[model samples]
Target chain A: MSKEYVLKEVEFWDGAMASSQALRQAEVDIMAAYPITPSTPIIQNYADYLSNGYVDGEYIRTESEHAAMSACVAASAAGARVTTATSSQGFALMIEVLYQASGMRLPVVLNVANRALAAPLNVNGDHSDLYLGRDAGWINLCTFNQQEVYDMTLMSFKIGEHKNVRLPVMVHQDGFICSHTAQNVAPLQDDVARKFVGDFEAVDSLLDFARPVTYGAQTEEDWHFEHKAKQHKAIMDSINVIEDTFEEFEKLTGRKYNAVESYMMEDAEIAIVALGTTIESSIEAARQLREEGIKVGIVAPRVFRPFPYDKIADALKNVKAIGILDRSSPGGALGMLFNEVTAAIYTNDTKPVINNYIYGLGGRDTTIADLKQIAKEIQANADAGKLTTPVQQFSGLRGPKLSFFDMESSK
Target chain B: MLEIRWHSRAGQGAVTGAKGLGDIVSDTGKQVQAFAFYGSAKRGAAMSAYNRIDDKPILNHEKFMIPDYVLVLDPALAFIGNITANEKEDTKYIITTHLSKKELLEKLPNLDEKRVYTLDCMKISQETIGRAIPNTPMLGALMKVSGMFEIDYFKNAIIKVLSKFPQKIVDANLKAIQRAYEEVV
Candidate 1:
């Protein structure tokens, strides 16, 4: 029996609550999850909804994240709409199974409250876990705030479960910052949201005995390369479906989303390329800089997995200099975002002076002041029409200024 | 933008108070953000929660702030929590303590006497709500000090926010809010 839940036009919700509510409205068949910091509330709230009769879904309390993802994979393969949430170390544990889920073409949804990986065992927001899973064959979607967390969670199911894209999707939100912070979120009515998400369409379901289909068949070297190539093509081709889904959602909700979100980029001279919650903060900084007559803007990849290289290049085409901010530690080289953005721009005619900024690791606060300083540095580069600072620098890191790759010295 | 900070112990309801305020503020079509820093701290450990209210969508996600108002929910935290950190020149402090404003300012000589407001939220919650949870009473005091909303309007909004609780508990919280609203100085 479903309980009477009066839907509000809008409500105050944290990122966790927003995502959990979306999961509930999607009416997922199974949620197998192991609790982790920051992400615990998402599954916890879903479990509460399940017990209270608001959602007719099964909540499996697995012992570990590995077991949780394993359960999700099993359920998804068995033709159940499956989803779960995890962060940090738990995400690392689930990495082994993430590839399996995608390789088997199971459209499972994983909500990752992005956190820093362990060394001193920190439980704070960063992109270390997000960066770690970039190559796991899951379509990654990044969110800027609580509202996007809800919006993207709903869209993830539609995009991943599309017939053309039968692959898993990961929605990333910065842990603590977005997950724990309460803010205003306008959610779709239950009936409308349900209609938008639609029902789970099972293809080659394991439960269908009459059609009995085999999954996870070992291809070995004979057909493995071809299989992998097909998987890559599916991921690349899913971009169209993702765009259409975004458009449909916009039509229903009037909130538009783009493959690459550009803010104040019209005729801008310098730009900050970033992701997650930092994008909003950088936009605020850029707005303040604009008051001082500085032509600074922000560009962020809302869809990170298929990597919208063309959109990113077009967004930054008019800028004279760019700063790519990555919130994860780059063990020995330039940041992942820096590498990707530069690769995208390398094919373009307008070659801007690009610099990498590694920042906000292990939950360090990325303040408006720090972002303003970054924009000023980019402006300096734009004025000089060449690289003025090191090719890469650390933002908000303590102690003496740490930087690398002095192009001048190399030259 | 209106920024506020709360200093309290982990068990105390600073996070809840901040979120409750956010809920009430958001109802008026204003953008609000409420969050806390939880560094794996246990109950009885010191913690802080924060709120930001603005007319436009808040684009800043940084925890750093020069708070316009500082709320100290635990009496002991008044002395040790560095409640004045990053406070603006016109920042108002609403503290929960049995001590009078003069006495609190005397003990913490650095505080501006004109800006300090004190009330016994712990006692009010104990007497009215039948518990020592001072967070609701602190909200009442903040309502009186900040005057961001009228007493009756704020209480009704909070009543809606606490609709999940039993009628008896909700009534008690309303009384606690009313008492602190009148008694805080």
Candidate 2:
């Protein structure tokens, strides 16, 4: 029977309920976290669960994210399903041990609400935090909406706990987009989530008292390389497990998802590739452009670790030029999404000129009008043969236009 | 398609009103969509909820550049921003104010004079329900302006949502919905 989960709709939430419902489905046995912007509610929600008897879990309010990950590592190694969440510099603080959680073969799932790292501070949605942990050995995935956050949080546990892929996973949601924006989400029923995830077996094969042995052994130089080599192989094998897990999740719940979902890409001439909330807005833009007899579509990249290179390349074969809409600047380099598009193109003939767009820095809004502006720029760049080696231009931002209005006049 | 642009700050329950309106009108077997464009991404910031009630499925998800009807739950918003941006010659503006339509329009002369219908929704909210969540109350004023449903239909529609609360609160809210339907001029 189909049931409607009547969540408080879009603007009413403080993100506490999203975190609460996810924690319930995760059935988290251990929670160790420090509070940070846009992600404080995850801990607050878990805390409420503990006090109200909504869930039976030991919630550990740690001093820092580093300590939190360390506690999660310990709990998972000792046969407990663990979850810890963080954002901004707090998420960046876990980069050191996050790698170890994978190499040590622990299945700790984390909720990373994406926010910008500091120089000038930002407290809103962006992917800089998630990008900083790209090589930390955890399987990283991004979500666009609150529904995806709830669904992906539960799916992360299943994906991590798969025996063949005993690695940690990070389910990244744009801070305010999914976290703060409330929506009606169909949460996983306890019986179904428990049945699917099953019982978690601790990684230590010698966990049995009868055959106790040392774990995390200090090895000679020769064994160190081989051990790390196996960890790399397991992380790579997660690609297959991710697909299988989705299949199982679909059977349990009637929702279908993918590593890379292509929208209206059949014989598309121009494609805008991006991730997170912008993709939803971009899809609407693409549909509108299609109505006007323009051949356009969106390549929404969901998984970031493996990057779904082959899948994206195969789909974009018919398309000509592609625009990479990145929310963050790569400084002297091109935007992050632009580089990924180039890498995905196997051949130069099939490779479209990828225009790198670094738009909406410091949590600026990316409206549908802004999306149309990007499309116009992409078309112009394509026409002028201007996309040469990933040039980053100043993008659409609201303030006094600096073209004629100098900042000194204001002071 | 009759598009209504709902103006409210975050946590003020305009989104709930949008969904409730969608549910109530959908019983008439009309196609409807309810969504919002949020801002500041916080507990309290200016936000806009939207509804497109039509005989066909709504394809446009963007905020309406020109809305057919405007519902303002906050009276103070009149001073802060242009709450009536998309008002056509025939568009109706149902605003929650402490004053009558003429007095409020005299204060906010920027608003269109031809089709503005201002009611004291806060008084309706306070007197009928004993609280100041003006979403249901403004819906009463909207019912008067748009002439879509009877007061009883909206009362039943509100009952579906308010049933989740305690009986006393739910009954009060139902009474508020009913009174707003009759009382709003």
Candidate 3:
């Protein structure tokens, strides 16, 4: 039984504090983490809770993110509920172990403070790290603000630990924008939150003396392909469990969520598709534009993994044009969001004119004014019934209007 | 909607002050947001903190703002901090200075003297809290200028916020707050 704690009806908290509180309430068995910018506070607060007798858990001070993930894997395999947090470079270091954790079907919940990959050396918000892990075989949940960060983190444990979906989960929030911004948050009572998360049930525990289990076995070209196929199937099938979990969470806390969220799209002709904190700003721009008779809308994927193709397509099928905003640099190609969204809606009878927008790299501010401009440009494309600008453009970049790919020429 | 920007050094508790103000404002069942721009800044490095308060939930996450109130916690920042950047025509300034309002206005020719308020927060905090931390005094001055909360009600709420500290320290902070609240002009 968990101890009961009195909580205010509402309290002010940053995304990091909210995440740490959720982790504490879940009564995690262990947390092994390496301190990194923006994300350090999540584990730091959890460690403080452990020291102050508020939580009963082991806090491992790992030398590096690689060691941290390795420790989580070992502990989770030993039948303990494990978790951790990291950011840009640290997440880059853990990429190798991330595959191992998911391949082993260990349900370790990882909180990511999404940041830009360093080259010029910046510690700011971007989607580079989050996009880097899209192929790592984890259920990725994207949050728009501090409240969602808290809710998604608490629910990640339940979703990942479900018997039908025994896979790792990643909850991502934009660094600084969500992680460092303080706002009002309503939290559940400790006992209620604990009961909602439930206990971790170990299946085929390595520590079980009566029944032994083997992990990390090497199956060469003979069986590796079959194992990967099964993993993919599990991820695809886990959507059922995810929906059920979201429904149950809504019942408990009246805050409804969906795999794909659409705002003001009932009769919209132009839409902006984005993720992370940009969703909120885009929504604000959409509202402002609607008042000016611009018929704009916003679409975002709450579940970044498994793509939520059907929901996204249904929400966006009616729009005439779309501006897909990608915060990560595409290196030398159209943005990843552009590629995925195009694929999702390509099968529709009437496809919307989709354009790629690469913006907000390395923590550059994405203002409502900028989003409004993107929406207006998309509106122009909708009215013209053709490509009005390049297929890909860089927004908010200083000096020079850099763009590429001419749709008319390609056609 | 009301927006506020604080100009201060990193170690002077500007971030703490912003969060504290958010905490206080949130109790009224309104929406509030507080954040700071921390770009590898060391202690004593100049930085700014911001706040947004409104009746409806605030969804804007951009750092750019046309602030309604500009607060200067360090006197030097009044002249060198670009305090007037993105300020509105009616934006009010609350600055910490040992000099009179007229004296400080002469130093900052671009500012409208009528919209500026000044107090010696350093002197107030040192006399009452036995230190030079000016964040609490600045909050006191804000309370006095904005009239957001009655002095007694604000003090009681702040006491709860500072409950984790020793009673002696809490009492000293109250004195600093009260002194600045009465002294700012």
Candidate 4:
């Protein structure tokens, strides 16, 4: 831990509203938004700040989320720092432009209040939206609470606009859990935050009349593959840029953040890997289980996009068995997070038996009691010296038992 | 650590009450988290807010499954919403009801006789503020029961947070809080 870097009195703020404050401090030149549940407060607060002279910018209320993202792409290409907020179906509506923002190499910041995608038409927190943008070629950051929401929103502008990593970034927080929950937030002075993010530098902007640049050009079969390959390289190589930004932020703010956060992992025999607010409860569960003589630990990947494979594998190297918790609905296949984690640790020397457990989709509550029960079950598997049940299961889902990948059937 | 669950209607100020109490607790340099359940954001619908106060940072963001204190801003919600689900046996119920402690205990089967406390917060709020919100009075009753803050501390906090409002509104809320503090039994 570094020395506390607070320069003013701490204020209580919820995650959504604080996100707006961070965006205001960044002094974004343009924001195009369409309001959506749990995420509307972000843009709403920013609009209020702009109108109250707290920020100098343009807030455009668009007709639809698609138009909102489209305007962001246009403003960003025209050499303006741009930002927006969306959730659930709103994110789904912007899917096409999400690719455009990344493909055109525009560094637009998006605050995604993670919410459940609608088929049953429910509005609540889930990873469906976060997962939807995973393959859209944007840098993804996960925050557990209000502090991270403020800190990471500032850090995102730095990482996404870095010359080496000019890709849009999505800072995700669980819907109601973080977005609506109020907590203490120590905000940096406006000038300090502005200096930390630094001045916006446009690489190849449409505003440069002398040096004409063409955007949205169709890269047919001849160059599409090569263009996409470079974009892939840029995102894959952003890990270094992200770490450097984290280091600089820590130096300035005295708050230390890691790519993969470990909780009681040292000498842990049973470890659970999760994301978002679920990690919060899992940590509490880990502490209680430790007192009960159960060697339980938790691993959470703070940076979800470039999916910190090596860091997470190292964190769980000593654990005997791993429980990978995925919050998104898995219709016919294994959970998205489970697939990525298993691939990350596939080549580890210890080769711990990792299982997939889907929980908390559609805002179903995942409590400490549920986590404790999972820890006990995974502990039982480790003691048996072999696989005890199916490798994949839906945890905490009400109704009859549902399990995938039966070990016996696979054999 | 203290965990509380507040029950009220959507138009009521349970969410605001949770934040107001959090403001006072955090003023004492303790960590606090305040949040409400999102159920369509419709008016007059049953809604709930939660608070967690501790000397250390709070980690659990899930809704309260077992709260130490349950403050009911609307007495009818106690039975209508099953507000006492998954509560501790010793959980204290500070309710805004015209019913006496004996009468409230008789009505709310889930509440223990010794732990239940009643206050006519709605009546006080209507008399002072001319609104039936009852959230400010409930906060006062909570402050009295939990001893979480001095009465003066909350009074100053109320003034600070509502400094932008009209004097009558502020004065009425302050009066409601004082009356609830004196009348909770």
Candidate 5:
């Protein structure tokens, strides 16, 4: 029996708590998770809800991250609404099962509070975990703050559980920056959110013994290629379902979301494409730089999986030059976001001079001063009709200047 | 928008103080964001928390550069980090210190006396809560300096948040807040 929760019209919550509240509202069947920072609060709050009788769900305390995800797969295949959360190394440990969940077309929603991987051992916000899960075949969504963390999570269930798109979804937010930061969030009424997410339709659940169906079947070379193509079609078909869900959510809450969120891009000659909280800061930077006669704008991809290439390309179709900020550390190469964005716009007629800046790895701060300098460089490159310096360099690097991968050839 | 920064040690209730202030302000239909900047600090190590309040939605989630006010929960941290890095023209500093305003100016030699407010928050916390957590008194002092919210609102909010605690603890915090509210100058 699901107990009704008395949710405030508006409340103050951090990102993790907001996500946990969304999961509570969804009335998930099972949450099998191993707590990891800064995503620990997502699971902790859910566990608290369970203990306090606020939510009706089973809270599984697994031995490790791998076991947590392994339990989620089992629960999902058995026709249960499954969800879990992890970050950094925990996410890396669950990487193997992530593919299994998607390959089996299980609609398990995972919340990932993105954190930097350990090498010299650091626990801070970055996109290394996000990039690591890029090609895992799950539908990926990005949130800027607490509000999106709530909204995107509710929508992830609908998008993943749709009949046309039976794929797991991963909802991500910056680790400590978004997870630990307390802010205002206007949440939907419990019944309104419930109606919007609707009911889950389990297709061929393992528990339906009357029509016995087997999951995780071995399709050798005979049918392997056909099965893989069908999986790819499902991911590609999710785009329409995602759009429809966003529309339905907006109609209910009056908050609209897009696959690609653009700020001041109209008539902009220079633009910066970034993700997560950086988009909000870049809006401030664009406002400040505009006063100094710089035609700067900002572009952010709200959806990373089934990558929003067409929307991203269209947003930058008119800009003269663009700068792509990637938070993940590039191991002797360019950042993953830079590579994806370049591929997105390579065939476009705009052919803007693109520059890739690998930044904020290991949680280094990105200041407005750095953005202003980048704005100036993009403006200069636009006016000169060419890149002024190296196409790719590490923004906010502490040590001596060193650009990566064919950067020397540019000089 | 009014942005404020708080400086304190790791175990000194900085995050809680900022979050408390956020909850109070947001209760009055205003928007608020409270966050901290730390590099895995241990107990007694220096850390900072930031608060941003505005009538509209807060878009930028970055750290503050030119905050309207700076509240120092520890007098010792003033000498280590750039506590006074960026401030508006008439930025206020509500600090916890044993020294008088005149003596604090003499020690710093750089701080202006007009905008500096000091109170013995440690003594207040010790006498009331039986600890060195000066955040309550500091908030009390901040309410007086900024005048963003009424003193009663803060007192009531504190009481409400600490409602689950023992009445003695709640009463002591209320007394600490009241004493600092009247005592800071």
Candidate 6:
């Protein structure tokens, strides 16, 4: 499309330390980050930003993730906008303060580069990070690529800082896919981005320094439930704020994205579902099937935290079967996303036999062939009218096909 | 609508090239979507990405299974990933390799003729930037094949995108892109 923009090619792995330089272009005023596998860049980036006068706010090098988020609370509470990033373990560590920030109604934004939390010592992309913290009362949004990471980071400030949604928001990007992959992102012009975002000042309240009153007063259990109600109200009320933020972002960027994006499933019998980076490959598979008149579609989830049920179910209602693709290991259960899709689709009247496809685990590569195979299998299974367990596993090439651990650990 | 699929490994600059191409095309008033299909593969793993430009809003966000244009960043991966099968009947194959376009076509006996446009960005990259990264140089070849965007426009776009980097690196990249843009037929 002949529109006015610049493009260039860049490398993905410039070392973890190089990542912060990318974010520094945003002119981040305040940042708090703690080290975690693959996600160390968030903190590393902020550290580099600190040494130079690259950003204006306090760069807190906290000892722990809990402290990192606590510092963000302190900074954001004092009326200076703040940013912090974390991964699986770090995300788990920051969980407590996550509730604290949301409950206090601080408009702090956190970028979650999702990774697997493990006894296996994994440092790859997975949903475990975001899923573990799903109920923590934060706006969770996933970006499929590095460009979206930058765009979402810029957009989050506007969304979180919005007057209507004074709750915290978590912008989630895949750990290695977007965080590590170097691509030719058209980093927004700083002045233009700032102008589009406008200036952010703390919503003045009675707690203004001139007036002098403390917020987040300890609530007694007798009325603590009611105090929690206000926070819940903010979470529910944020849907509108999130929508308005996206509307404004679309206006500024001329690129539109929704909480859920659908591709060519209309009048189709089977649907292949996914989110983030996996959408690209799945669409290719869908195109192949389309040419064969196999009739397939895809629904990529954009917002997993609020769990956009209405959007997902309404989109898939016409389909006869849906294949759910998840990038993370569900362990004994199923892929985290597959479980969520099933929960969303379980109640429909004209029900489709949804086949949950678990794949791309341990940071493995999922290709169009893998997706195409799953699409065909799911279609056949649905046509035969016999599918069970809500998940049809499509595993990649097992180097040795042996279960190495094999109950030896139990002994 | 021009649907181009770029095949490269995860750490390669294919996705960036895709986005840059989309950015350049947008300058010509077309709607475009630049996205990558990545696996859990680490940095050295093979990956496929894409760029689509059209006169209208693109509803087909899926990778162009039948791509009008195919950019093979690492020629070796053309076989490993079976990228050859994704090529359409009359698709343009702009590959980065040491072999000439004719030589490259002969190498892939199963692949068709006429649509083939092979380039050795490896040679061009070494001559210009002194590095093996042929992303910008291959981008020049893509510009030549498509006529979707001008070489000068892409050169300007490269300077703007890489302007944030050091002057030496910026100039090297500019030279690499310029050489490919001008030399590729």
Query: Which is the leading candidate under DockQ?
Result: 1
Residue A104 of model 1, lDDT score:
94
Which of the two, 2 or 4, has more DockQ? 4
Give the winner by lDDT. 1
Cα displacement (angstroms), candidate 2, residue A170, comes to 1.3
DockQ, candidate 2, comes to: 0.20
Residue A170 of model 1: what lDDT?
A: 99
Q: Rank order by lDDT, top first?
A: 1, 3, 4, 5, 2, 6
Return the lDDT, model 3, position A63.
98
- List model 2 lDDT by residue over B1-185, tens digit each: 78888888777788888877876776666766666664345656778887777775433334445688888888887668577776778777777788877788788787745577777777877887788888887887787767798777777766866776888887877777777777666
Candidate 1 residue lDDT tens string, B1-185: 99999999998999988999999999899999999997889999999999999999998999999999999999999988889998777899989998888888888888854488899999999999899999998999998988899999999999888989999999999999999999999
DockQ of each: 0.89, 0.20, 0.87, 0.73, 0.64, 0.09
Q: How many backbone clashes does candidate 3 have?
A: 0
* Candidate 5: tens digits of C-alpha lDDT, residues A191-260: 8888888877788888999999988899899998998899888998899999999998898889999988
lDDT of 4 by residue, A1-411 (tens): 112223335777889977988998888889999999989999999888788777778999899999999999999999999999999999999999999999999999999999999898878898999988899999999998899999999999999999999999999999988998998888898878989999899889898999999999998999999999999999989999999999999999898889998988888999999899899889998888999999998999999988899998789888888889999988888888888888888778886767789899888888898899888888977887556778888888889988988877433
True contacts kept of each: 0.82, 0.03, 0.77, 0.62, 0.56, 0.03
Q: Give the alpha carbon lDDT tens digit for every residue of A92-185 in model 1.
A: 9999999999999899999999999999789999999999999989999999999999999999999999999999999999999999999999
Q: CAPRI verdict on model 2?
A: incorrect
Regions more than 4 Å wrong, model 3: A1-4
Clash list (residue pairs), candidate 4 = none
Q: Can you rank all candidates by DockQ, best first?
A: 1, 3, 4, 5, 2, 6
* CA RMSD per model (angstroms): 1.1, 5.7, 1.1, 2.9, 1.9, 7.6
Which 10-residue window in model 3 chain B sums to the lowest lDDT?
Answer: B105-114
**A315-350 in candidate 3: lDDT tens per residue?**
889989999999999989999999988888888887
Q: What is the interface RMSD of candidate 3, in Å?
A: 0.6
Q: Which stretches of model 2 miss by more than 4 angstroms?
A: A1-22, A46-50, A184-188, A205-208, A211-224, A346-349, A381-390, A399-411, B1-69, B85-91, B143-165
